[model samples]
Structures are given as structure tokens and as C-alpha cells.
Target: MTGERDNNGVVGVGADLDSLFAEVEALRELASDSDKARDSARVYDFGIRWGALLSGRLQRLAHYHHRGELTPHEQARYEKLRTELRDVQPLAERLGIARPTIPLEDRR
Candidate 1:
């Protein structure tokens, strides 16, 4: 759960998602600190890129789900991604960054 690889040297998707969520939270915190006046270009860039990657992955997952090819595990992953995107989108908007659009079919 700490995101370190296990004895098998394999990382779980949950760990990866946790790490990504931590990163987004860090960026959001930094961006929202009113007294710091930090340069936020890097944070914005990272958010945009991460959002794009999440959106693309969700799109593919939705396609598979629609085709009845997604496994239960994949459906769980899709829900996780969708939830993360929902959280991130609001932060992006608050930061004045362009949030990646989740397809209509993929929105919960």
C-alpha cells in the first residue's frame, strides 16, 4: 500500500493509482496556497498531461465495456479511474486549467 514493489517485484494498480492521487493532491495543495505565489506552470502542465492520459484510458475502458469484453476486474479499475477524474476535474477548473473531458458515456 506504500507503493513499493512486493517480493515478486510487481506493483498493483491500486498502488499506482494511490501514487497518482498523491501527486494530484500535492499539486492542488501547492496551487491553492495563496501566500506562496509559486510558479504553477509545471503543476498545470502535469495536470493537463495526467488528465489526458486518464481520459484516454477511460475511453478505451468504456469501449471495452460497451462491447461486453471488460472483465470484472477491469470494470473495477474503470470505476476507480472515473472517480479520480471526477475529483481532478474540479481542481483543474479551480486552477483555471483546461480539464480533460470525459466522454458522455463514461460519466457516472
Candidate 2:
């Protein structure tokens, strides 16, 4: 039962991340359109929403990491999340969106 539950959780996380990636790609396309003014309200709205979503995801990953002593697999998963968050931070900054601050403990 525990194994099933863990697999379900992993699947859910993968689905959520996939959805978020699609949203981010859509936002990127919108931002890159020649007709769209960068300073337009629509752009800012999307940027803000994307930033919030990314921030929430990072926080959840951090919470998961700190939940208990992680097995090797869990540690690897957490590292991947951290790397992804780092990769996205600069894009958020470029969009004039506030980037999430990853906790110092998670830096390791």
C-alpha cells in the first residue's frame, strides 16, 4: 500500500510539473510575439501568475526535502528540483517577475 501511494505521489508530481511547463511555454510564446508590448497589462499578468506558480512549486519541493531523512532516490529527485528552480530563476528575473528564494539548507 505504501509503495502504491508513493508511486501515485510521483505520478501526480510529474503531471503537475508537465502542466506547469506547458503554461510556461505558452507564456514564453506570448512574451516573444512581435505585436505584444512587453509592458502591456496582459504580459505582466501572465508573468505574475507564472512566478507565483513557480514559487509555490519550489516551496513544495523544499518542504518535501525537509520532511525526513531522504533515501538516495529522494535526494536525487530533490537535487533535480533544485537545479530546475535555479534554471528558471533567471528567466523570471528577465520577465521582471520576482523569483523564489530557495532555502539555504536546500542549497546542499
Candidate 3:
């Protein structure tokens, strides 16, 4: 089912981001010519795209949350999304990827 696959995709994105983080940490000591270093760069790129998609979803969640129509549980879900946005925002910049802009209260 589409919903099932979407859930898998979300999990996959998180996995990729974790792998990228591991690669980045490994890169700190490895030289550029090393195999691990090369693989890390590739994985890091993949992570960036995944992060962008995830970021977009988080932004939409924030938008809906600010609309003030959701239930308490839904509001909590959006707050979690905001937390995710904050986490990935720095990673995007460190990876040299364009950061996603989440429209918040000041913009409305």
C-alpha cells in the first residue's frame, strides 16, 4: 500500500541521515584518498536530498500548527516536527546544502 511505502520511505530517509552522520564523523580522521572518505562524500550528498524532503514536510507541519485548528496531540506532533527542523538545519549547512526555510508565526 502507498501508506506503507511512505512509512518505509520515511524510515529510509532517517537511516540515510544516520549513515551520513557516521560518514562525516569518520571523515574527521580519514584522508581524502581513502575509500571510506570517498564513500562518505557520496552518502553525504544522498543525505542532503533526503534531508530536503524531510525539511519540507516539517515546514508544512509548522504551517498547519500555527493555524491553531489542530487538537493537542496534533499540536504536539507539529512541535516534534519543529524539533526535527532545528536538528537538520545545521546539518544541511555543514554539508554545504541549501537550508530549508520553515515559515513561522512572524511570517504570517
Candidate 4:
């Protein structure tokens, strides 16, 4: 939040901008935990590592959607994440936050 902002002040309008940053950081921490857990068991692999990365990114994107300020890329990513999370109900419960729905305008 310490850069040259555009005419809008920040990059763009975010409904819950403050919480967005905090959630993203928490997601990163979760990813780090996933990585460490795998590495500790000598089960670390490219795919698993990438999964952790994707998980973290999805969480951050969800935060953006919750704030009503997702970009085009984040919007596309959100759809995939929502589907994946839906399939893993237990994981979703652990997250304690709902996945984001695509805005009407972004729907096919």
C-alpha cells in the first residue's frame, strides 16, 4: 500500500481491501506449511509443490472475490478453484470461508 496509486487512489476498488491482504498472507503461510510437511517426509515432488502453490493462489483469489475486486485472471482462476473446493468438502470446511461465485457479467 506504499506505491504510486492511480487516479482511484489504490490499484482498484476492493470492498474488503484490508482483510484481503491479511488473508493472502495467511494463504502463503498455509502453502509454506504444506511444502514443509511434504519435504519433511521426503515426499516432496514438483506436482505436490505446485498444488500447494495453486492452493495458496486460490485462497488469495477467493479473498479478492470476497472483496469484490478480482481481476480478469483472478476471476478465471476462481471458477476452477470453486469447482475443486466443492469436490473437497472437508478441505472447504477447514478453510472456514466460502469460495467465490463468478460475477454475472463474467459468466458464459
The 0-to-1 C-alpha lDDT of every candidate, in the order given, reads 0.55, 0.58, 0.47, 0.43
Report the lDDT tens digits of candidate 2 across residue range 24-106. Answer: 56655765675563666866887777777667764555555566434556556667655665665555566676665765335
| Alpha-carbon shift of residue 93 in model 4 (angstroms) | 14
Off by over 4 Å in 2: 1-7, 27-39, 68-78, 103-106
**Model 4 C-alpha lDDT versus the unseen true structure:** 0.43
Q: Which residue segments of model 1 deviate by more than 4 Å?
A: 1-38, 103-108
> Where does candidate 1 have its weakest 10-residue lDDT segment?
1-10
Q: Count backbone clashes in candidate 1.
A: 0
Weakest 10 consecutive residues of candidate 3 by summed lDDT: 1-10
| Residue 89 in candidate 4, Cα distance off native in Å | 7.7
Instruction: Please provide, for model 4 over 53-89, each residue's C-alpha lDDT reduced to its tens digit, 9 standing for 90 to 100.
Output: 4455444455556665556554554555455444443
Predicted candidate 2, C-alpha RMSD = 4.7
Off by over 4 Å in 3: 1-48, 51-56, 103-108
Clashes of 4: 0
The sequence of per-residue lDDT tens digits that candidate 1 reaches over residues 8-39 is 33234444445555656665775677643245
Best-first order by TM-score: 2, 1, 3, 4
Query: Candidate 3: TM-score?
Result: 0.44
Kindly give the number of clashing pairs for every candidate: 0, 0, 0, 0
- Give the C-alpha miss distance for residue 84 in model 3, angstroms: 3.1
Task: Record all residue pairs in model 3 with backbone atoms less than 3 Å apart, i.e. clashing.
Answer: none
